[model samples]
Target chain A: MPIIAAQGLTMRFPRVTALDRLDVSVEAGVVGLVGANGAGKSTLIKILLGLLPPTEGRASVLGLDIAREGAAIRERVGFMPEYDCLPPDVSATEFVVHMARMCGLPPPAARERAADVLRHVGLYEERYRPIGGYSTGMKQKVKLAQALVHDPQLVFLDEPTNGLDPAGRDEMLALIRRIGSEFGISVLVTSHLLGELERVCDHVVIIDGGKLLRSQAVESFTAVSGVLTVEVQDGRDALGEHLHAQGVAVRPEGRVLVVDIAGERTYDLIRDGVADLGLHLVRLEQRRHHIEDVFTS
Target chain B: MSTSTIHDIGYRRYDGPRLGRGYLVRSLYVHNVRAVWGLGRPARAKVMPFLLAAVMVAPAFMDVGAVLLTDRAEVLMRYSAYAIYLQVVVSIFVASQAPVLASRELRFHVVPLYFSRPIAPLPFVLAKFAAMVTALLTMTAVPVVVLYVGGLIAKVPHPLTHLREFLLALVGCALFALVIGALGMAVAVLTPRRGFGVAAVIAVFLLSSAVVLLVQNIAEFRTNFSLAGNAGYFAPFNLVDIVQVRLLGAERTAEAVPDGFISGVLALLLCAALVGGAVAVLYRRFRKAGLS
Candidate 1:
């Protein structure tokens, strides 16, 4: 069963319609929410967390009805907000431990679990320091620690890579990937950068202007074989003519000639063509697409 | 589900302060305290109450010498510190106390953080009010002690009666602190900007006093109809002052339930109303800002 499912979910802000009749479902594993700013990613997560009431929709997280069972859903699920909220005065250990206790962990257990989660989030050395003194990266780790201290079944990370430098961003992304793969925790992570999500997410949910543009496995995003890219050093026009004469689909793409391999034997024909033209084939490979490629067409 | 995983810390289903089967109130309260402590300025955390103590004591020391000069210096000694001088101290002390309690939070933008935690907005408001009151008590108690000892060194009248009055003064100070602190906190809650909070507090205090002063002049020069005659008696905080004054049976200047008590009562009622209204406003604001 899908761990999270939404059908025709629409979220309306005062001057904006955040999510427009969007439908999405994720069974388990890490799913990435990718979109530009104002793309309704945060709205969807807030609604799921029971923080915001949707304007129009039906949704569920872990089989709990979002509208009626929000408290229950929130109780079982964890969320990491995008902003810098950690009070600079208190230590991470104290804050996370308190959160664990609030989540209903008894005193002793709250303390122990708080310690474990802080270490897990890579704040072991600075757990006792006031959050005010933490680097941005450390603060992000504290936010994550609080979410995980109670051991929720699923976690929602909103723009987790935001505001980090390249190196910090890479480390955060790696840690996120491990959360899903190593700890076996289900994650719903949002990011505007499709390439970053492509690396860590099992499923990718693309949204644009508060609408579901696409939703599919990560493989569907990176896999494409419909268009063929061919390179030739000489007789590029003749090669195109020959390919057209032979009824193979062909188009000129700048210096290289792009073709549609009409049959399985087209590779052999292309090789022969290359030999006939005495053109050294610089490179020949199936065209693999990036997530950005889908954005174009 | 009742059993624990090997990696589990093995906590039994928490039956310990069932804060409730599922009420979100307790969670909100827990979250606010956690967030406050988590922000981690321990020195400031401790300093707030300590500074509040200073504000409460500052004014009472001015009265200590006069009390020691009197024939009833013992009465001044025992009563001056906590009760008799408490109103005088707090009336002026609240000027600074109101801003620190209300405005500082506004300056920090920690309001959204408080609202967004897994807690209700009301608890955040309540905890802040509580913190301020605790600070007030600390600031007031020390002056009461100093005046009591100062009066003893120059004993004149019944020392034991002074002690009884001092105890009453403590009660008076506590109630006074609650009403004023609640009012200040409510003003802070209304505006997320510290400057606005401070301005609101000063405006409310100054306006209330101005209105009372206008009424006093009307009663003295133009109309014999005192606010006492018009029913707009300007004494809300008088009850605390009443007990403090009443303890001095001989030295008392006016009735315990004077216009100030009426004014104090109105202030208290205004505080309660403000807390309710502010919480409702904050609930809407928090939801809109995505705090919860």
Candidate 2:
């Protein structure tokens, strides 16, 4: 069953409509909610979490009605907000343990889980220091640790990779992947960076200006295109000319030659042409579509 | 020659019992109580509250010392009038700590994290209110208890009568805590910045008392004692003093308190109103902050 299902959800603010008739359903793996700024990604998460009431329509989380059973849904789900919400005065261990108790864990369980999750997030010795002294990367890890300390079946992580450097971003993405696969927890993560989500998400839901633009599996969004990319050590012009002479549509893009696959003959044509020119072949592979191509197309 | 391999312990799900809403409220209340006294915080945070508390309790020790030196029971300070004599210290304690309890979460954007849990706004606000009231009660009641113990140790006359008055004063301390705590929280929550919150709370307490005293003195100069008595309603400390003197039969501390049983009932009702109104305002404030 889908973990989250919404039907004709509409949210209207005074001067603007944040979400308009958004109907989307998400199954339990690592799902990504992709949207630009002001595209209502946070609004949709709030609605699902039952923190905000929709102007119209209905939704359910984990088969509980969001409008009526919000408290129950919240009891079972955890949320990590995008903004900086940690108090500067307390250590990470203290804050996460307090948050764990807020989720109704007993005292001993709260302390134990706080330690376990902090370790999992790669914060060992630094977890004892005050949160104010932490870097942006460390603070984000603390926020994530607090969310997971409650041991919820699913978690909503909003822009978890925000304000992270390249290495930190990669580590966070890898952590998110492990949360879904290794930890056996369903995750609904939101991000505006399409490429980053493409690397981690199994399904990507794209929204634009508070409306659903596209929702599908990442594989479908980036399926193999009918083009072959041929890269050689030298004589790129020679490869393009030879492929065109064999009645195959070919174009040179940067150092590589893009050839339109006509049939099985396309591969043989490129191999014979490269050998004839005595050029060293470096790469030969089928080109695949990217998530960015969905917008450009 | 080691043959044992390392075991990979992955994430473990919590299948244990998850307590209900009452546990969450209790945890929040305990946390806020600790915050008010700066417990579980840095050493610097503990200085203000402890210093003010020592200042609050010092006079009780001095009064007891005087009784022992003079060897006269009548020289002891009145038990019921303890909080009023130390009113400024109590006000400072409330002013400094109210911001820690009411506005710290709002200023740091932590309210949304709590609301996203299973708890609702009413329970959250009530827990905070209860914590503040508890802190204030402890602050005000400790000195009164000290004075009573010192009275016993000093061997003052009419010890049984002293016990009765001590019990009555304990009731007064509770009323003082409730009324002043509610007003301070109401004022502090309106200003999210801690410095502004502290200033605003102190301003409310000082300005209201000053204005009420000015009005009462002017009315007394004109021989309008009734009007002077009614003016006590404007200040939180005097407002509860009226309830104490008229209803609880304690000695009057303020310049004038409204006369008769009806006036006492009205004062109690106003105290109740202040508490209820503060809770309502806090609920709205936190709910809005959560959404933001």
Candidate 3:
């Protein structure tokens, strides 16, 4: 069964329709929900977690009815919120251990698990220090740690890297990637930055104004630009001419040749042509369309 | 990959009203840790009632010797209601904030994080009340010990009187907190905004007190104050005055301790009704928030 499935989900807020008629299904991998603020990413996550009552439609997580078995579902899932919420005076070790206990872990087990998860999230040495005293990066780590302490099956991270600096963002991202890959936890992570999600997410779901724009694997997310930039050390103009002579559109892009091979057999043609030219092809890469294309469209 | 693997890390048991103990206790821990000397990251959060007690009571310790030497020592030596006093405040604050609690969690980004797992919305509300009560209960003890010990050092007379007050104070404090807590929580569940809920609560408190007195004062009865069960409704708010009447055993007021006891019971029932309503509303709101 799919880990999560939603059919015609809708959520209405006082000010805006936070989620429209959206449909989604997931089968256990790190899926990134990419959207701007108020795009209904948080709303969708809540519905799956059985936190929000949808205005319309039905949803299920881990093969359970989201409406009826919400508590059952939540017990198995983990969540890292976007804002700073850890108590300033409490140590990360104490907070996470407490969370683990709440998740039904016995005292000894909760402590052991809390310690392990905090260490895993990169708060190893500083776990003993009060979370309030910790840096932003450290606080983020504690949040992540508490979510993982109970060994949940899936984790929903709402803009996990929201307020961090560039370096902190990268570290948080790395930890997220590890959560999905190393810890074997399925993640439904959301972010405004599509590029960041692209690097780590196995699958991507894009939304705008609470509506789905596209949902596809990372491979399908990247669109092939019209022009493939080709570079050769000795034959640049000659290569452009050779390709042009063969009815392939080729334009000189400085020292490289931008070729238009718009066919499934383009790779074959490029290979054969390069072998025929008696020249080394240093670079033969298709220009990737930026994520902004989806927004612009 | 395997079905067994899925079940290993999943929530398969489906049941009704499985209260989430984790969230209930964790909420308390969060409140406790947050308020206990202001210890976590979200540093700006106050844990208000805890701080309030410390601020209100700390200065009283400085003049312990002087107070012991004076006649006013009786009030200080009356009883250790430190726990009761703190609990009352905590209960009041908790009740006042209930309506705003759900909204705050949503606003502060804690709701989604809280929801992502098998956490039910009802637990958060219940847990919050419990946390506030427990936190209030925990902090109330410190001041009692401080005051009690301070009295000894100062050699105050009738130390037993203070101990009696302390004992009664626990009962008084619990009744006070529970009564106010139930009402505040109900109001909190009904409201959405923190400020609105808080303001509403303050208004309720001020208004309730005014109305209670207004009714008592203006009513042309055979007598204004009654020592019977009919007078039970007004006892909690009028506790100090009731204590003055009952303990002093005046002729006009009932000389029986049972009269005082009955009043406490009736007030407790009122609190229960309010708290029960508050919990029910929030729980429903939580379910709606979680499931469509």
Candidate 4:
């Protein structure tokens, strides 16, 4: 069963409509909600979490009606907001324990879960230090630890990789994937960067200007294209000219030549052309369509 | 050294008993109360509240000391008039701590985290409101209790009468805590910045008391005592004082208090309105903040 289902969900602010007749149903796994800023990603999450009432239509989370059973739904869900919401004065352990209690965990259970989740998030001895002194990467880890400390069935992580460096971003993405696969928790993570989501999400839902643009599996969005990418050590211009004379559709894309595949002959033609030119072959492989190509196309 | 393998227990799901809304509210209330006292926080956060609490209880200790030394009943401070005597300290305590309880979450954008849980906005606001009231009650009642206990130790005459006055003064403290806590929270929640919240809370108390005192003095100078008494309702300290003097049979501390049983009932209703109105405002404020 789909963990989240929405129908004609609309959110209208006075000056602008944040969401317009949006409909989306997502199965449990690592699902990505991809949208630009002001594309109603946060609004849709708020509606799904039952924090905001929709102007029209209906939705359900974990098979419970969002309009009526929000409390019950929230009982099983965790949320990590995009903005900086941690109080700087308290240590990470203290804050996460408090959040655990907020989710109705008993005192002992709250403390234990807080410790366990902090450890899982790679925060050990430094968890005792005040969050005010934490780096941006450490703070994000703390935020993530609090969300998981409650032992939720599903978690909503809104832009969890925001404000992180490249290494931190990769670590956060890996952690999010583990949350879905190893932790056995369904994750609905949002990001504006499609490439990042492509790496972690099993299904990607793209929205633009408060409307659904596309919703498909990650494999479908990144399926192998019918073009081959050819790279050579030298004589790149000669290779392109030779491939063109052989009636092969080829174009130079930087150091590589993009050749439209004409059956299996395209590979043989590239191999023979490189051999005849005495140019060392670096790579010859079919290019897969990227998630970004969906937007550009 | 022998090679050892690290164990990976993995993430464990909590299949234990999950408590209900009441438990969540209780946890939030406890957390807020501790925050108000700066417990579980840095030592620097503890300094202001502890210093103010010491300042609050010092005079009672001095009064007890004087009674022990002089053996005179008059040396003991009046029970109902204790808060009024140390009104500045109480106000400072409320001003400083109200922001700690009311605005900390708002300033840090933590309200959404709470609302996203199973708790509703009303209960969230009520828990905070209750925490502020609890903090204020403890601040005001501890000294009065110390004074009473010290009096008993010092052996003031008519122990029963002292007990009755002490009980009535305890009631007065509740009223004071409720009214002042409500007003301070209402003011502080509007200012999300801690410094601004503190300034705003203190300014509300100071400005309202000053205006009411000015009006009371002018009315008394004109020999319109009833008008002066009615003006006392405008200030939070004097509002609760009216309830103490008129309804609880305590000695009047304010310059003038409205006469008769009807005035006392009206003062009680006004106190209720203040608390109810503040709760409503807080509910709306937090609900809006949660969405933001």
Clash pairs detected, candidate 4 = none
CAPRI quality of model 4: medium
- What's the TM for model 2? 0.97
Cα lDDT tens digits for candidate 1, A112-213:
788777666666567888777888888888888777776777889988887888977887888788778766679999988888998999999899999998
lDDT of 1 at B228: 33
In order of DockQ, best first, we have 4, 2, 3, 1
Candidate 4 chain B: worst 10 consecutive residues by lDDT? B1-10
Q: Return whichever of 1 and 4 wins on lDDT.
A: 4
**Maximum-DockQ candidate:** 4
Global lDDT scores for all candidate models = 0.65, 0.91, 0.65, 0.91
Candidate 2 positional error at A257, Å: 2.0
Q: Indicate the residue-level lDDT of A225 in model 1.
A: 72
Ranked candidates (lDDT, high to low)? 4, 2, 1, 3
Give the CAPRI class of candidate 1: incorrect
Ten residues in sequence with the least summed lDDT for candidate 2 chain B:
B1-10
Across B1-292, the per-residue lDDT of candidate 2 in tens digits comes to 1111101446888998899988999999999999988888888889999999999989988888888888888877887788888888888999999989889888888998998899999999999999999988988899889888888988988889999999999999999999999999999999888888998888888888889999999999999999999999999989999999899999899889988988999999999999999999899999999888
Off by over 4 Å in 1: A13-15, A88-98, A106-114, A124-136, A230-248, A252-257, A270-282, B1-49, B58-118, B141-168, B199-203, B206-225, B228-292
Q: DockQ each candidate and list the results.
A: 0.20, 0.57, 0.22, 0.63
**lDDT agreement of model 2 with the native:** 0.91
Worst 10 residues of 3 chain A by lDDT: A81-90
Off by over 4 Å in 3: A208-211, A221-227, A232-246, A252-256, A262-282, A286-297, B1-112, B115-119, B130-170, B180-236, B239-292
Q: lDDT per residue, candidate 4, A172-222, as tens digits?
A: 998999999989999999999989999999999999989999989999998
